[model samples]
Target: MNHLRVSGLRKRYGEQEVVAGIDLELRPGECFGLLGPNGAGKTTTLRLCLGLIDPDGGEIEVLGLPVPARAREARRRTGVVPQADNLDPDFTVEENLLVYGRYFGLRQAEARARIPALLEFAGLSARAASRIQTLSGGMKRRLTLARALINDPDLIFLDEPTTGLDPQARHLIWERLRQLLNQGKTVFLTTHFMDEAERLAHRLAIMDRGRIIAHGAPRELIAKHIEPQVVEVYGDGAGRWAREFGQAHSERCEQTGETIFCYTHDADSLVHHLDQRSGLRYLHRPANLEDVFLKLTGRELRD
Candidate 1:
């Protein structure tokens, strides 16, 4: 059975169309990423898919169950890790899991039976007795992940799963997510970090202003939207170098802040020009998801 199906999905807030006619299909055991900037309706779409909020138009189904009609049943089989941590500071780590278990209609004995394995899975075996205030940020996040799995769900929803995490912590979370995917669990993820999406998502959709602009594997989207090579130059005289040499050498060039991005099919001539120049540093690399995001969404900041 398919993990999820959404067709002609739409949600509006007053006059603003937050989710404007979207459609999606997620296979079982696939990590489907939803990417967008602030106010792009990603969060709204997640709520809609879960039937937490009614859509303005369209249909939703989870595990062959019609949404909002049988949303409670669908949610019983789903685990959700929200963007923010809302763990109760009043409770200890183990207690937190046990309390969440009650919400899933699991008994105390049943919850206790699963705590040890869950703690071990989250690398929080020792922190089980600790209070929420006593744990570090990473520890808290790990605990939240463990709590989401308390129901032994078939599908998991992760909202910006690695936000504000250090590199090491993020990698650890990525590894855990990998393990879940390997276990044949369906993962629906929303994230702003393009690298995270590129690494975790089997296939992804990029949304802008409440609509999907691109959908494919990371490599496919990159190939379709960006040049083969990119050279980023910055430092003193970078602008002058870009104006004088970058335009002549690159197929396309863009200036953002103090950095100049040159997109080209071939970088040999560009590298030669950079080698001849002084007081400028540059990075030469293959075009990636971030390039596609910028090309489609623009580099402007969204609030």
Candidate 2:
């Protein structure tokens, strides 16, 4: 059975619609990614799914329970890690887990008994006695993720879970999330990092203007929506290159500021042309998820 389902999901504020007619499904043990630029309504969609806010139109079912009506019950099977760290600075690492477990009706004794195992899983077993304020950013993030699992939820909602962290910290979280998937836990997450989505998500949806413009496995989306190869020509004489050789060799070309992107079935011709053009730095590579994203969303800044 699908772990989560949404059909024609929509929401609005005044005359402006933020989430419009979105349909999605997630299977067990998969990481599903929701991606969009700023103001594209990714967060609103998440809130609606969580039943924290009512949608103006459509249906949402999380864990086979209709949301809002059965939101409380569904939430018991769901874990949430917000964009910001909301850990209590006054509490110790172990104490924080114990306190959070109470919301799921876990007794103090039960919560305490789970603490050691949870700490070990998060690599915080040695720091269980440390105060929250003394922990590093990465440590705090791990604690937050650990706390979310206090109730042993089947599904987790991670909102920009690794934002602002160094590469090492981000990879650690990714590894742990992969471990969760191995154990058959479903993860639904939102992220601004295209690379992150590409690495972790088994499938993803791209939202724009409050609607899902595309959804599929990352590789599938790339193959369907973008060229197989790309030649990114930047620096001096880039615009001239686009005008002269772009249309002749490429299936599509897009110019954004100082860079000209040439999308083609093959990059041999473009690479040959670049070899002749001195001082023009160019990169020929297989089309990536970021290329597909920029193609669909435009290279212009959202904000």
Candidate 3:
């Protein structure tokens, strides 16, 4: 059975439909990423899967159990690391895990037995007695992840798990998440960071205005939707250059504020064209997921 399944999923707030006729199926032990801008219905979709909210139309099966009907059964096998850290401020690091374990009906002895291993796994063994306020942002994030695992769930949902952390902290969390996949855990992730999605996700879906515009492996989507080369031009007269030669020289062009991006399979011709223009700084690089994202979603701001 698929780990999670959604077919014709639909939701609405008043007259505005938030999720429109969505479909998804996640296999076991793969990292699936949901990517989009603000107000793109990504969070609403997550809520639907988690049985936090009911969809007005469609069917959902999480771990083969129909959602909101068998939601408690599904939630027992699933874990969640929310966007915000909701760790109890008054509880010690170890105490937080113990308290969470209780929700799964773990006995005091069983919860205590899991605490040492969980703390060690999260690199918080030394801070077992420390208050939540004493831990750094990264440490707290790791702790939240550990807390979610108190019952050893098979599927984990991570919502922007590395949002505000430093690079080092982010990399640490990434490493730990990768380890979970190695242990054969299915990870469902949602994030705005393209690089993060490209680095960790085996498959990704980009949502816009309640619909999926693109879905596939990151490199595959890039190769299928966009040209191989991109030239970014900025500084003075960039707009003039785009207006003058964008249509003739490149397969596609996009302008945002003072910067204009030209996409092409033939970089040499575009480079030759731009060689004559002065006072405009340019960068030439291979197309990436961000290019695919922008091409599918356009350059307009969401909110």
Candidate 4:
């Protein structure tokens, strides 16, 4: 059975609708990714699911309980890592987890017993007594994640969990998340990083302008929406090259950046065509989540 189910979820603020008719399901032990540009309603959808805000329309069932009405109960089994670190600067790493555990009705003794494990899980065992202000950006993020897990939640919600972190920090978080999934915990996440989504999500949904534009496993989405291979040709004479290439391979050409990208199932055929042209540099690779996003949503700044 699905761990979380959302159907026709809608939310609006004043005259604007932020989320419109969104539907999704997350299975046990799965990492489900929500991808979108800013103001595309990814955060709004998460808030509705967590019952932080009431939805304007539709239904949300978390752990088999209807949301908002059963929000308190649902919250008991849920963990959340928001996009920003809302950690109190005055509190030490261990203090934050202790306080958060209290919100879930864990006794002081029980919270204390769990602190060591939680600290280790978040890679902050040595920094347990350190104040939040003294911690690095990555350390703070890890602490936030540790605090969320204090309740031993069955399902976790992470909003832009690895945003702005260095490569090492991101990988550490990813490794910890993978461990959770291996232990049968479900993770629901929103991120702008396509590589993160592709690496972590068992399945995902792409949102745009408050609606889901695509949904599936990362590989399946790529296979359905984009060609297996893309040949990108760049340089000053790219337009002329594109015109000439488009005449011979019109069905395969798409213009992005200062280059013409030829999409095809066979890379050799496209490479053969490009070989005849000079003053052009080319790269060939498999399609990815970013390619699908650009194809479906177009390349435009959301902000």
Scored by lDDT, the top model is: 1
Clashing pairs in 3: none
Scored by TM-score, the top model is 1
All-Cα superposition RMSD per candidate: 0.9, 1.1, 1.3, 1.5
Stretches off by above 4 angstroms in model 1 are: none
Each candidate: what lDDT? 0.93, 0.92, 0.92, 0.90
| Residue 91 Cα positional deviation in candidate 3, in Å, after optimal superposition | 0.6
TM-score of each: 0.98, 0.97, 0.96, 0.96
Candidate 3 ranges with C-alpha deviation above 4 Å: none
User: Which pairs of residues have clashing backbones in candidate 4?
Assistant: none
Ten consecutive residues with minimal summed lDDT in candidate 4?
244-253
Ranking by TM-score: 1, 2, 3, 4
Q: After superposition, how far is residue 42 of candidate 2 from its true place, in Å?
A: 1.0
* Model 4 TM-score (2 dp): 0.96
lDDT of each residue in 97-167, candidate 3, tens digit only: 99999999899999999999889879999999999999999999999999999999999999989999999
Total backbone collisions for each predicted model = 0, 0, 0, 0
Candidate 2 error regions (>4 Å): none
Comparing 1 and 3 on TM-score, the stronger one: 1
